[model samples]
Target: MAKNPESPNPSLSESPGPSSSSARSNGAPASAADPRSARSAAAPGGGQALSPGASSKHTLSARKGQFLISPRRVPGMQAMGLQPLALNVIEDTLRSSPDIEVIDTVGPKNIIGVLADGMSESPGVLVARMTDQKATVLHQQAQGRLIVERDHPLTLGDSMPLQPMMVSWSAPTSGQSLDISVTVLGRDDAPVADAAVYLFGSMIPATGTTDARGQVNLSLFGETPQTIRGLYVKPKTDYWSFYQTDPDIRTDEPNVVGLRPLADWPALANFPQNQVYGWGQKAMRLDQLPNQYRGQGVRIAIIDSGAATSHEDLKKIRFGFDVINKKTNPDGWSDDTVSHGSHCAGIICGSDNAFGVRGFAPDAEVHACKLFPGGQFSQLIDALEYCIEKQIDVVNLSLGGAAPSEALEQQILRAKRAGIACIVAAGNSSGEVQYPASSPNVLAVAAIGRLGEFPQDSYHAQTLTQMVDANGFFSPKFTCFGPQIAVCAPGVAITSSVPGNNFAAWDGTSMATPHVTGLAALTLAHHPDFQNAFKARGPERVDRLFQIIKASSHPINLGDPSRTGFGLPDVLIAVGLQAPMGMPSGLIQRAFSGAAQPQMMSAQPGQSMMGMQTMSAGFAGPYGGFLPPYLGNLQQGLPYGYGFGRPGW
Candidate 1:
């Protein structure tokens, strides 16, 4: 792809990709200038690849990473005559690179190869994860190989975690376990079923889901209530998550807790959040669009925590990859524990079956890629490779990392070349945009909130800043802002599906990105210019798509271009209804190729204000008895409404 000088952010010129994998078939190290040796130990929790001006001296470590060794250079956007390389080629490449540990290997036949050499789930997938300078050297030398990313950490913090994405519940001590029954209710005094209830006790942590009667029986380690640390009740949807630091427990009687409903505002009784489309859907004017424009022909992928396939609305989402547990439970990708991916899936393809919430593109083919709780960059890159091979037209990435990965940048370029569009979150740091989203090759979206769309006194109200515009839409104070923002969408108090046939109304740019991804699917399925192969199939197709979406968007009067790029994209205006335009040869490509903004590489190392961000009922409040940076920074981590609207840090 060619670089555009007139782009919003001036990006550093990218160096040519590393040498082809075939070139290093001899296993000898390429010189320091070329730096090619395919082996290094994997760092447990990897950091970002260094930018210019940072100390070049780093532990040259590498870990288990997928090795995409192909015999030929990558083909063009239209890979005409492309054929799978011979198996000997793969065998020879592995034989030559002894330093590159072979954790997994998937061959052409989907053969039961020794996963002691673990590889991609299916054929056409071979992975070897690694990071650090050793990983960088290997990637650069093995250019012809598809990609070798760090398997860097990714979380629902829709972010990359500083620690390995592993959190464990303590097993109970030898003392007798006591059973306690708890009931969850909504503000309307209605029983809240399918809600996740957690009890953080001194010696034991117990968790359970509320049943139809809104009751959950929990067994604690001690007979007395003294072992309790805290209690957290998270509803499936239509209510706020409730957390109590300490509570007076009367084990003798039934315990009950109530949550605030998302639709509690007396003035907006007509708006039933569960039955009606979310404000985000209406803001994009999905209701105004024709019934025929549903995302029926598009393939959309969401990389986040797993999703709850049992959810009625998300039942259409059958295709998935459990990147977290690929080999063990390859078919268990839909096992959403965190509920983040389920939310994004609902926003994109959730159906309108029997009192369920409808998505922007309810008919689109949905593929869920679970990587939350803990995900790595290497994992993300591998997922992208799957997307390219899977013919995924659009992908939603509602996660971020503290630092940038040059390997990821190259992979994004490849995905773009392969004609896949990536929609990413701008981050919730209240600072410059995060990587991937900051990459000009992708579309980065910020979060915007409209007044009266949520309960006035609920946690959702905490996101209201004084920045309201004439239309009542305000740029959230937590949204990462910069010249890289491509657009804004409804992120505040967003109501979407969680795990276990439930729903939750939350905030963060993570909640905003899916709107654009869903819209992109609809555009590809219906927009005239994107309807045919000639106009839509090419390296620059997404760039052209971005041009159309941005050019046709109506920006809210937020008065900050950094906060709201082209504002919200209008679906009707894009799909040839409101303002249809003639499709000329390379018309949009020529003018809009350079319009994207990817200016992240130029920032000084550590200037990135982003930290580990995980979304848990992000209503302003002080949280975290765990660790710093992991749960630090309100704008970065917990932005709940605490005293004076400050972070827990």
Candidate 2:
């Protein structure tokens, strides 16, 4: 690629030119010194190169694909042409690094193919075993070779304790000696002769020594029970017991064996959680919901920062557009101008894997549409337009600026016109509910603490003074409060996959936004008919689904209009699939009688506050041993109603 002199010095995506203030806010230093100028002396052609003495104490790193090679210089070589010396230095350093093994040089191939040695800590090792993507080692100790694969079950902590091979077995007999044979093979598949063997059966002694053919025979005597078991020929250490055995009388079942802990079978958290960002073994239990709508065919567009498409969790991502760079880097580069985009992607459709965490709709495909790194109104508009052009079903916008732009608002309206569901985050500034969300068309999500705690309105500073923390009942210190917020979910301590196959936890309305996006995917999956119906009815299908979601929320009146928009969104209710449970008829009658405003009700009622509605039968009333209390300041205000005007006795 020859240089385009007229092009901007730094390769930034096409965009409305940034204002002077915007550049300053992005931390651009005002200094005009060209650091590369000093390098000319080191090159034969007067090309730029830094002298060893001139090297600054701080060395900036350069990343190419998965490789993270630091600053260094190498003598020019004909083998690599006259490429930057830094690239060769990094390659050489990686070759010697214990944790990395260069499978091949990409320069000659024009295509790079490399794998991470998860078993080692090489400075240049790129792939990680427990990250969003998983790396499988071809041999033990992760030393032989590595392969980056998509199977989620084979993760860092997964191990096969026993190797497949043949071992002899003998049932116990009364007053008769029991004999058994066993063999252990090496990588060559050849037997290791003279190995020790231990035979164990119910009420029988186990002992043995192997012959030259790698065969071992064990004899035991006792009122041998029908059940029998066996163990390896040799023990690794005297302190650690070498043999294991189990006795099951049934001929069809194999005997059970137990190994004593020589060392704790290392905990999953200990196995480089930093790589997968410690997404625990458990993923979001979508099966636990009312329906398991496998999102096999749905495409959800994540319009934010670029995604780590190569991430083990997101191997199925489809690149939509690079509104910023104009060029496509589908593997989502770690050099994300903003991190919010990636975080939102993880929450919506993060790959379900053994080593890392899972997403609500793990099977749904992703379309990475990078728009705003730090909230550009125009970029948001561009991304919305891009999603509409692509016909993406779900568009997740996790970034929001000061206010909604008319252009941005109209784009959202247009998306709804085209049957796209837009999920926008309630801004984190604790400021007023911003655009898109406030536009009444977007599903505006607010941040809620682990136990439904939301920040009190910061605007009412004088009123906030009267509130005091008790039982840790106070709202999250930073959660934004507003009427624009539709629902809330676990926004704090949200862990997701990050670049470099690592994990990080972040909190914001940004975190809450993905839950809604994921739920929408599931909704679409279950009700594909709804989508078809939309095609028949045109854009109104967008609001129809929105109405379904709004009608299904766990309503709570927080007194303050700016806090919870429609109450907490109930996914099951939104999708019309709540399970049936028992309820009291008298309670239901009283609830409706107490209501003055026209009420939309479910077919039944239950003691739960989720997934069921009814003017007659089943109503959620605190089933599952816990009842939702009256919503916010409403409990203190109107004695007859909880919050949101839900009738009370």
Candidate 3:
């Protein structure tokens, strides 16, 4: 086997070594004014530790309206009643630090802070908090320079405690079921699947998906539901609403049932308490989704950092490999110290339990291919190749980089030719969309901020439906922009399982990509025949399946260029179950234009699905269901940290 160069960190494995500076330094005179002088002076009895009279000798510099002082003298100001203004002072200092190598930042609270990787020269001093004006005055009295101008008024209102939004939920109601059957219409009354029809009563009683008909039956239950006489149902986030019409009531007939601007149910009266932004009840539309994906034979490959198979929510991660650490066990990949992989993985295929947020395809199998955390182009290629060899039907690449990789693009093309659906994140950096998401065969997804039905702002409120095109897609706040974005979904305030079976709210394109992957898995579940095409002697069937997915997408013209892509993705479209007139005519022409050609698209042409072959291309079938149960439970599977490598290689 060919050997790859080894470049693991030696500090974790080897002993100390002499510094080059020490070895090269000849007998040079040490200067008293050097910045390093403070360290030597502070050394235990090494020199004069600030003499009493000289202790107050400090200089203050002024730039614009801001005052700069030695961080060491900051404490005396605190007792004078002054407080820090910004949420993060540590971050500001590091950006201006002269001799420190900053790594990452973490704030204990909402206040700002900066983290540096190499700042041992000044240990406690590296972390600094600003003292308010009152504290500044107190410190000035203690001989430290008060940098404030005498003419400038000190604002006491600069400091205030941060109060994060808190939401609590009343116990859910049981027994009473609010059965709702919905009929969704598009250009000409065309039915749309996964349109997420939610019936939010006091609390959600029961949820079900729509069949071939765009009808969803919600079994409503909650303590508050019993108290409220009239119930109203509305599309969760976008501009849409639905209600049940009762013809028998002659007293005061409300003409519109299932229409926008619902008058009967006070919008604010029945709104649910806030949960974590995305993982909470309001964040997910699955409960409103039909259970059509249930029992489907679909396998989704989570190609990110790595999986925490041991997580209670994701214990069912049957098989996974570490491309970064090159390890076999799932444990080493989840180091909270430096990682976003585990969080991304937990969102994609987390276990569906009470403890954490449930995944879109909770039952689908997750083949974790660690390629993001300690990113390398080669690792990503290895993961793609592995998925192709294993025949993974749906490959979700949640992580992305700026410059496109031709090698990675080639692998995605291979996966597409092999009948493997590729789902990539639309890059997090908002302005430019990244590849393979930019690849034609891949489905690129964007993020959306979460909101409840209760109106916070009149213009912002009133039944916001998950529309085909909206600000939900090209979240200007995040990265990854350009025309490649295929669809948009909720990405903000998402709560998922983390390491140690705990849960926290997170955001990123990584979270958005999985929603599309799960939807693609649902497509496979409904059309088991798509997988069969890869098993046949030719690629014609697989090609047809791709055509089907293209055909099913709902074309949206929301008047916004940045937010809307190809509109929203529908499982029925990908499976050839539903065809809408709004689909791009050009795409349709290309798909059928070459229908006469025998397998115009093929992954290495000769490779055929001859018999009952094993689930090679990331297909997890012979096992009965598409995903493992642990991947479904939101409670147990979230990995804690996103670190690569174990104690040893």
Candidate 4:
């Protein structure tokens, strides 16, 4: 929650007369001889604690025929035998007294009027007449400089009084049927008209559909208090699909589910051939890995602006929520309002279809947690809590802010305690890494583009280094540098699915984050024992996973270690298809020599040199083309903060 500070003192004048300093030029400063000195001397607390609205009386002399009067009390002045003229009434008054002329008027509510310079009335006589008319003649000035003085209007203070209320509900009975009511909402929490709901794992299958209010009622029957193991919801047209296997449900409370609609993908007259770029497949070495460990049965959540569920490359989205709208389901709307989350998702588990490009973990279950538009602190915490409750294996958070939030750090810690691994972008600000990436538990990834394999049309292509260094490949101009960076990945001009059933290219550390996320999913899929180790070793499991990926990376000899972390992670080596390289053989052994050992081997010194040469040459071939600038009209900046990516110059 955001806090509001108290309002400052009002600027309006509260004194009955203007101080001598008020008549000075705008650039002049107050002097010791000013009238404020007398007011300060007479104040109750010696001026230090004087209230802005405190009132006081003072006497002063002014030139004859110069008087100030509030136009609003003109009628009262006429009754007291004093002439108070207004602009409209001047024509009428002038007919009676031809010498009188209205000089000026000021102020909003109480219009202050300066009488003519040639009037025959004396200042003393005018003041006496004003007193008799029951009108306030605040002050008199020789040059006809009229200043209005009155109490300032009342305002509601900053803080509001809050009242607490207590209520009680009937406890649910054990061994009795329970009725659960679920509500489905669209983008911005709009109600879904007709959504089908199903309840599995019961003696008899129960099903219901939402009406106009986006609600449905279902009864769960069992001998004992039954837990809903599998709840499926299929929304009407334009809505994204939802499936929650095991929900955190209490028998006593109503189970309300909010849904967001998947925005329709822009239609196209002709479909382009889905060509998987070299950076997408070669950088992670997805071609060398086997299909069996393609992230099947693993649940990975993309905590970003939601994904394009309607994308042809995305085979199925298991579950999704619009954190921005506080809904459980997509309201028939695409989650990629910024087209960032969808690009990240394409690199994670895009369907391995013939027409579109395939992802590293094509079969992994993907969940979109939309938190971009309204990326509030509490909304982020709620998204993480949703992941924990769902028992998601991995969470990819490409968003980051410069200032660290302790509450956000605690949420990441809680996710870690719940056996969930968080992978974050190291940021594209070209400075120190941003949080929650800087936090100890999450894996912070940096960006790296191939030397000669640069995207031709990309602005970063001209800034690419000529040769691949010991750090594998480097793209230094835009990537952030810091000790928190865990690894680097191909991030420049990477092509992926957009919201309109189309493929486009993007550049950012945000684009690099999902590469590591996909690899983590593959690791969990291939090594089921890692999950068991996560339960037993706690955070050490995360450390071991990080070390394995780091150790398996192809080391690059960059000038600054902070720019590239350990090195570029090779999915082939990470999943045990290829041997680990670059780092010392014994160091890799010592890092993973724990109780939860992964399948790894020490590389021979002589063979390691030959393998590095072979790998370097192989990576050099894909280093030449340019990525066309597709997002020419989109605004630059990560959804949450300033550290993501900037528009190409």
Candidate 5:
């Protein structure tokens, strides 16, 4: 590996541009030549006890913010109150104390914060600055708040709470303890381990993941035995998340719950493993695209769990990094244990090798940044910095979170300034768009399904809504909605590569996002407007890319703009071409020989003779299903501390 990110990696097809800085361990100072390294430096004015390596784990619990204190915002300003914040006062205070590092100026006396504790004096020293300067800090007992100016306000809240740092945590020392033993079973009474079991009563559910014997032990504290109001079982893979309401149960013995299998309902049904591509490729018209426009010269990144380099279709991907393990992990970004990233990668860049599924931009350069299975906000910032340093053109964020982070917002803005277009998933919670996606700087995408594109017996039918347009396209019931959605794409029954060289069909807004990202890559690499915009690398290039996508989109009658934004962005329209006149052209595929190859456009709904895959009640794979809706890392982050709410499988 090169010591400097700027030095060419022998494996990369094209050398990365002169980066602003090299990626280093958390908070280490950068060479004077590269200033972008300042994005995450946690060096407080005076050195103290904590070392960057020493504080690495603890830093995951850090926080930051800058509040505006003006006359109108101050207490009793008209009568006899203290004056508002001034630049000189803030600077002097920041200079005199070793707790805060001044980031940038919003206005006089109003300094905007960038990231983690700047002062390395101690573990929480840098974040404590928020308390001293403007923000009100809180600890384990209650959720914290850090005032932020909303770029685009929504009806969700009057204030967006600062995700707590979770500096320290411990369970209640004294309380009425209750324990429940449960067993999870799959189709045919097979054991289901790693399945999350939540027992909902009058209080928040007591949660636990089942062990290999399909057993889980859950304990909660209260006054006495709590009534079993509901039992929800969520398996990690290939099973429908199960929910049961009010039933007879005894805490004395094992409680059993059964889950529906995600696929192979009729046994040996031909999934994408036998097909050339998934339905998404056809809906985005990727199947009909010119063979030559395979996202050549475009560099893309998947900032999710990780990509399986060993996956046959993903052999061409040569670059990746483990953000959570930058100082360690030994190039393990390619070891995708979660399989979510691999699936998304296959959708974006899988090879058209004729044996497995095809990707939208099979030839584009892909760099996977491992940030999930376990990742924090600070780690997310580092990943985007790596993107900027690597000059990545398109970023696919299949993850999401409920709370917004100012540091993340700044880092994303920095990437945009460097001309990177970030396309994110509108969540699958059937709620409003999640953060990052909700940020105005990035493009947010929702999920859409064609009426007959997937099997009716499959769970993909569960997502089918009454909002189907005249063209048979409809907004999926599980996709998050609101004004933030930039576009919609095929997210139901999306078949792509998983780990172990096998392929699986799945669904989610996570699947929908990559379609747009893959299309963005094609436009950037081949569009004339994009070619010209690259001349002067700035925010304008990003703006142009976004404009072309929206302007080229063909509207759908999904009823609400919040659900599908401008609608599905056409590949030809996006790359400065036109949709064929008169009637929709049959899939115009072409081999390397450049010969026209017409193919089936789509499947008719309810037309199949028989036997498909999966139970008719839910979605495809784990987290990929619409019922449980991959909750991202929300449960892990709790009161807002760590892990992106990845809307992924």
Candidate 6:
């Protein structure tokens, strides 16, 4: 009998063994004892026979209340466009049979058939009718090449008994209890209270719940140091959820885990003043450079949920399309029902007006491609095709799925072949980079946060002091990490425009992706050759762009290269400008060493004491003095000397 490709019932293996530490101490065997050992011993050759009246030698039996039909694939039918025809024959034959009702199709090849209650005493008659109909169709259209068979009844002996297994790891002890602290954070970068965190691998596994500060402390009672095999967050009714970490965490420094909420934004706060030049812009040194190229003539498309077309800051939106609704004109379809698309668009090209926040590439014309409503694989393909047809320079895809789909991958490759550069989020799952981003042709961006920076604050001071030995600036707890990461950017507590002409701070690798997209536009606008290569769809265009971005990035000293990639990108270096002196080097170490600080003369020297005081206060804390030269000297302040209030985005 042919098995269904999609519904194969592979035998289950025994559960895993217990933690290594527990197994060693208790002298337990490595494998779990088989629960079916007794039955196998009694049965001859471990082969059991079916009960009487259940089945016959020639035909398989069905359950007393239901009938099963298994459709056999016709070789070469798919190539001839006859696969749909086979399905139609099955449906029509089942519908025409007396008291026969088709329930559903199952399996990858659509081979399984479920029927409702009818002829409960005998299903052989129904099965024979289905077989005859299938044979007749094949004879008429396919020269009787195809076949159909009745599905066999599932017997008790067909499946193995499930055995429980436990995971274990070895731990060496020092005869001292280890104190460990853990902080759980939400995707928004806020503390998650009351969520349970479990610690396993030791003889006595410890567990605790996070408090108001989203922190939990654990004390291991083992005699010496031991490995922890697993650390997981127990599922709860709240908004927080967690993913298991690999190479289990040791009982050393406090661990920080980020949990994603059901919704991106749980609440909103009022927009603050001093909104221009957000930390993201400052980190890339956009404030100090000349505004000769703000992506003036670049064409970029943000393919996400949708964008707020009428928002004051998003007036530069020149074109819009709804891939989900299949609409060309903006009416009703192009509006951002979910604020994620609007936020990403704002980061890329929010208007440069004085009233609201400025975007990275303020003059770039952004096109909104809505795809979130019916985010099917086909819809994503259509969106990519649209980008190719329109010759879009840059496509900001701040969305992705956990599993890679071949159809989606083919579309991304098609876009690459047509010279469209895609910037994708590495996901917020804190694991492997998600699909599309994981695709080599696309640029995958990881998220980073300033050390000790809080989400509510307007400006995340660039305190590289703590990150001196580290590879990147911010190692956001939630951002996914892997070798596919192309670059790192500010993705934590990032403030951008929402749907209602309002501004809010959001966090995710989604937010980080647009920073690269906006910078790519600036790079292309400044270098005409790169733009020409992009338009010509040169094979080396994407590779060359990746090389340029990496070449311009500042080194982040992370233990895992997969996490930070080539560190953070500097717009100055990317656009052919001289490298800045204060690009997150050893400034913080020098400050703590009592070294002479760099000075800058203010327009009014005496009027700068307040700025100096603010800088001093920021440096005096535990996360002190790592500010770069541009932001270090508070006396010079913002372009207009806008006090020490949090710098805006």
Candidate 2 vs candidate 5: which has greater lDDT?
Answer: 5
* Candidate 1 accuracy as lDDT: 0.63
- RMSD, candidate 2, Å: 25.5
* Tens-digit lDDT string for candidate 3 (539-579): 34434444454445454344543453544456545544555
Which predicted model would earn the best TM-score? 1
- lDDT at 504 for candidate 3? 39
Q: Write the residue-wise lDDT of candidate 2 on 1-649 in tens digits.
A: 2223233233332233332343245375422233433332233233445553453333333211221112111111122242222435545644553334343221111111111111111111122112111112211222211112111110010001221123334444556665544554432445544334555454434655545555555566652335454343342211112333343323233222222221221222432222232211112224356425656666788877777665666665756667655545534433444455666677777765654446767778778876544434444555665665566778777765443333343345556655677877766555655545555456676655432221121111111212232322123344565544555544554566566454444556677778778877777776545757754322455555555555544534444434544445555554556721222343233222322111322212322221222110111121111222322122233222222212211
The TM-score that candidate 2 achieves is: 0.44
Better of 2 and 3 by lDDT: 2
Model 3 scores what on Cα lDDT? Answer: 0.43
lDDT of 5 by residue, 202-249 (tens): 544577888889999987665234355656665666554555555355
Candidate 3 wrong stretches, greater than 4 Å:
1-285, 288-292, 327-339, 453-476, 528-547, 555-557, 571-649
Instruction: Show where candidate 1 strays beyond 4 Å.
Output: 1-100, 104-149, 157-236, 241-257, 263-274, 532-534, 580-594, 597-649
Better of 1 and 3 by TM-score: 1
Residue 95, model 6, lDDT: 67
- Residue 24 C-alpha lDDT in model 6: 44
The predictions' CA RMSDs to the true structure, in order, are: 16.7, 25.5, 23.9, 30.6, 19.3, 22.4
Question: Which pairs clash inside model 5?
Answer: 44-119, 44-120, 86-109, 87-109, 117-126, 399-646, 400-645
lDDT of 6: 0.54
Q: State the weakest 10-residue window (summed lDDT) of model 3.
A: 640-649
Q: What TM-score would every model get versus the actual structure?
A: 0.62, 0.44, 0.44, 0.50, 0.57, 0.50
Model 5, clash count? 7
